[model samples]
Target: MEQTIPPAESSIVEFKREWTETARETFCAFLNSHGGRVYFGVSDDSSIVGIDKPDEISRTVHSIFKFAIHPSAESYVQTETLKIKDKNVVMVTVLEGSEPPYYVTIKDNNKKGRVCYIRQGSSSYEANDKEIRSLYRKGNPIPYEQRASANQNLTFLTLAEYFKKSNVQFNEGKYQTLGLKDLNGFFTNVGLWLSDQCTAETRVGFFLGNTKASESDGIFTFSGCIIEQFCKIRDLLRNRFGFKNKIEPYTLSSEGYRNEIADYPELAIREALINLFAHRDYSFENAQATVTSFSNRLEFLSFGGLPQGVTKEMMLLGISIPRNKTLADILMRLSAMERYGIGIPTIFASYENFSVKPALVCAHEYIKLDLPRLQQIPSDLTERERAIVSYLKQNGASSRKQLQDFVKVSYGTVINTLRSLEAKKIVVKQGAGRDTKYALTISLR
Candidate 1:
């Protein structure tokens, strides 16, 4: 009897005379695109070439799916035996994978590489970046932080130390749990952010006036481990914008008190900083988070505007859909942030008693939080009253003679300014006779 002939090769069916390493590429291609079948022991020209060891071929095919395809494509594939022309052959069928694009690992010249394959016509071809992105968009969209990084050789010493301080286990065994590595044991993009050799840039700029064009008082660039960068940025902000202590002398019936007032509420600043780090889009390599300090306000800007299905109103209402889930998870585990999605609300609430409200502006590519500085001194105060208030803010309580020396005015001019401030209840007169001094009564609220 003439041997049974297989159908001609097509997009949905492939034939191989024998098992070869390239077979794994075709398997990946099938899984990434539409499902297809590969018939081992069959010639490309639809001729049956029976397998010498059917059982062995089946076992080898199973092994190839197990170790060669990324993200475990074996679950979507199956292998069996068929008898054609009274001879046995191996048949491998791959179903379209739900999560793609699947990649196959190749080894050549003592080096290993990964390539995503897609079925084009009747052949498998390496997918370009655009094709891969389309596949991701069609399937479950993969978070950039969850994708494997190009640099496989990575070290997480900084991350390990951070976890150690937090008493969280961060050894090799917990890499998958922490999202440092994928199922295939490759370093992921999240791991790159936490690595000691991270190259992502984050910047903080202090302008002399109120805009970017103004002379930069200072600029700080942060790189490497993200945790360390957070700490450093926090410290820098604290030093530049922290609160100052103002003493209120005792009155006839009330005891003396001290108040700590800051340019911007410290809690609001911290929440904005944490939100900037947690929700930023890591996929935009050129974009970065920036803290621009102006004379009257501080602006926190980060790339990758609000997440999908989230809006500025939703954020104000305490709704959060994190752009980078793994990064946010790690931050939550470290206790650096809470999962309640209240960071923005907390920032707004911090300024509820203040005259100026915090503003949130979202655009296509970036989001910004503007925090207005505390202005306890009345905006309508006279120039001399403003001068006196500024002087007292810097020098604390001051005698009339000292105020005169500081403001470069006569004692009478100083006394008139002080009396006007006192009349407005913006200044408090302390002590008696020559020991008298004036202090600001500007309430923090």
Candidate 2:
């Protein structure tokens, strides 16, 4: 008799009772991250059930590696068989591949079923377009925008018109200056993005409420030219989130002009939108830059996290490392971006006079900039109303019980306050009965 011990499941270790098509995803994941090993004929509890026909299984694994994995993953994989307690176990070892961003081809899907995967802790997840782009860039230092476009027959009517409007020449020589063409005179991805005939899917959605599940107030999709899309999105955002003026008689002067108060600062919104479009990862086909407006805040979500070595604190300190340098340069030439990397800091400074500050969140694969609404509270509102409004502004929607806990008031008092706020259109009630949650209403005026 023989004894064997198997390792527990971990970031670099996985156990499978048998081979499955899904295992190919894990294989790609291991190749994307640090190398990892997979044990076949093993249980989740480290029990070795053993595999039947180990040699045939090994051959089948080899065939899968040869035919299934894309961009050649065979060099990174090795297989062996070991007998313990008279049971045959197959161990498949996978090393981190030098040519990363590997995808496993699944024919069942579309014609091109190249899906990339990445290992996250103990689980494997499908890599987003941004991650795939990052892997491609990591394997090769050249940025995606600099790469030649697959569609060679591209036109730049929109781009030419933009240059004419900006008082910049749009001759053939300017193409090289703007990164529109490579040395061989082929249209680059940047050229395709700027072309009038380009077909990149960019979209914007305005929801009635804060969350995506809320009813859509408006939805707009942009294609064709990148500059045109940028202008369209900027105009739509400005029209939607722009200042709403409220006229109030001046108390300081008896015969003076009225004060004009805006719902949000225009400079802050401008900087945020510019930063979002300028820094978003263009390699991501599935993900688009999104501007979501809730009642109390607006969120600008862009693909790709902070550039390597740049932190959120550094961003606040005006340190900028643009992921798409060509795009940034174009925007800078168009006068959309300033020379110094002060967009983030300028956004923060825009809200200095307001009670709520803008928030900047950097995640593993994306960045989010949240701008809080500068709503004016009615002077006649009670203390409870002010507290409830403040809570909802900071925490989004909340239930009566939750509000009561935060305000330390009676349940009836909370309910009455909520009703009063709702009556004044300050907050809107969602759902009914116990599932009820109150959210601030859109402060357009």
Candidate 3:
């Protein structure tokens, strides 16, 4: 029995006269490529000649896929016999190989090697060295940026605006360049994160007192693309505190100036926000980054602890390794963060003058950073006096000369400030006369 074929050969569809050893090469090709279908008993032209033993051919195809192809692609390949005008054509359907560089087992150059094939145009041929290496890279562990997104239909208005504001060109032409889409025209996970359809959010809760013991305050959530959320959260966190002006005490001369102090250091808050976004585990759908602002403290909670073998001590020492390199790079391009190890150190430095330092609880599942509210800085400190106390807090015990030079003040002024701070219990004097040195009583955070 025979019937006229309906169409010609194409990239995803192929015609074969019979099931031969060469058919394995094409099977390997379909697995290596985006997957395809091969119809046997069909000629190169739109012609079909029925196979005499359809049962035997089907059995042979299954046996080859099960035993011959590398990594056993039998699970992804299936064969069926179809009736075309009284003629039977055996059709084999193949799905894209989960593990790539699918090849037929063979011997080449006196060594056991693989015979790899890839689809090009309407033909399948042996893959070159470059193509084979590429296939090997697409292996058991795929990078997050390369994985296809579950949602294909996505919007990027927010992302486009962010890119534009950063003066970076963002268009369909840059999809692959920016790793927003894969080579097969599917949106990648990176695209999903940058798109308006992103599911991650930032949650903030306002609680009473220094704890969340009783919930009567309020809560706010920021969503959409992580970029937009970052901006919104940054602004919200920034505006929560106001400034205070400090002046020198008992200064008869015009040596005093206004010292603007903030409840929380601006740099510390910014760094915490950036770390929350760039390093926290984005893979976990059950948790999100959050902040809790209480009357006496601010706490930041994030999912996923320090990476393997990393500890809290190392983090405090400014050792940082980003969990997502690609996202980190993108954020850096936007000038959103610093490259070196300044973030954590800056945060710790902001609390340098406090007796009770900030606390960090690092666990396997999550990390919690607790920053005590503004408490150490006395409102009456003059600009020069505050500078002296800050220097002592950071540099430990310092001589009168060191303090005078650091604050660019007269030697007598430095002595008076140190005496005043010592009387206030903020600074402690050591030794006597020329051996005198002052140190902050408050421990570094």
Candidate 4:
């Protein structure tokens, strides 16, 4: 006959015969680790035979652990009956301990106590001194992933292979090559692996995960809204400013002008991207950096107020502190970052070289960096002067009548404003003949 397996976590079952001390140890291990039901009447081979007196057998097993064991173990014991070989049998069930360190005790070895036991896989092993110490230190914790039994079909191919295909370098050795594998089973069984319990869908959306495994799970993603802003500003640079192909891939190659190059330095842009990526507070879902562009300017807006005990002046003056050290270190090793605490200076220096002051607009929870039109002046001008400058800045050259309309000023007032600006050396006019073009003199310093 096919032997009957014990019922799943049943409070009572059949007991057919005398139980062994090893059987008690197995039940204790179950209680200490994860709770389980033990069928006293069922043989290991699954043949079931009912005990003669179910009540007596239940009391015997109960007294064995509660009063018989040295450190009085607590458990839920239940007695039930089952038919085995056409005879009724008694079953004893033991539930897991709310706390652990459930050891085994025997009548012969009465002096020895605290000899704990735990379940490792299907086998019950004597919990050694070292393992017990580790468990005690850990507070007998249980991971949510393990409790939920996520990724029941966990395969290294599912996670590690993807990294290899992504052009990431990894060791070809045994599973040890993957740091995840090297971590004790404790880490893996606890849901450290990419499992259904901790799926990377939305949680990964706001944060940027490391391409490298040691850093963090690769579930983190740069926010979609932040990337949307980057594209918006980049698009404006191309369409309106006539800055054809201005947003180039990040590279060390020398392109554009030999000396003039692009207005923004490659290092400066790199630092900006890195700073925006690294220093951003991942906890703030609404604070990703936002970039925008207008006719001749590109603006980078980022969430996060300035660092503590610092000011807009200090930020422009090149003071910075990183909030995420682990995330930053992994990115730097992959060449995604240049240096820490130096991005602000690098960005400011990029504009300084162009002789145009980069404006910083600090808000309570956000910072808006405004890049004015390429030919616009760094002005402390009144509203009227600003209007004239903004208008003439884009047109290259404008007639007196055009300037009057653009600046919304009277003919006499327009002439005086232009001459006053020219005298200050902030704006200049050039041309041998009447074909003069007025532009703001680049003097960022």
Top lDDT hit: 1
Task: Give TM per candidate.
Answer: 0.55, 0.63, 0.50, 0.34
**Candidate 4: regions farther than 4 A off:** 1-266, 287-336, 339-380, 391-405, 408-413, 432-434, 442-445
Worst 10 residues of 1 by lDDT: 246-255
Sorted on TM-score, best first, the list reads 2, 1, 3, 4
* Count of backbone collisions in candidate 1: 0
- Candidate 3 structure quality by residue, lDDT tens digits, 3-27: 3344988888888887666677788
lDDT of 4 by residue, 227-291 (tens): 22233333333323334344344211254212222334445545655565555533343344544
Question: Model 2: which ten-residue window has the lowest total lDDT?
Answer: 244-253
**Residue 119 shift from truth in candidate 2, angstroms:** 4.9
lDDT of every predicted structure (CA atoms): 0.79, 0.77, 0.75, 0.50
Question: For candidate 2, lDDT tens digit of each residue in 268-314?
Answer: 88788888877776666667778777555788898778777788888
lDDT order, best first, reads 1, 2, 3, 4
As a TM-score, model 3 comes out at: 0.50
Model 1, 45-68: lDDT tens digits are 888877888788778777767887
Q: Which stretches of model 3 miss by more than 4 angstroms?
A: 1-140, 243-261, 376-445
User: Regarding TM-score, does 3 or 4 come out ahead?
Assistant: 3
Task: lDDT for model 1, please.
Answer: 0.79
* RMSD versus native structure for model 1: 12.3
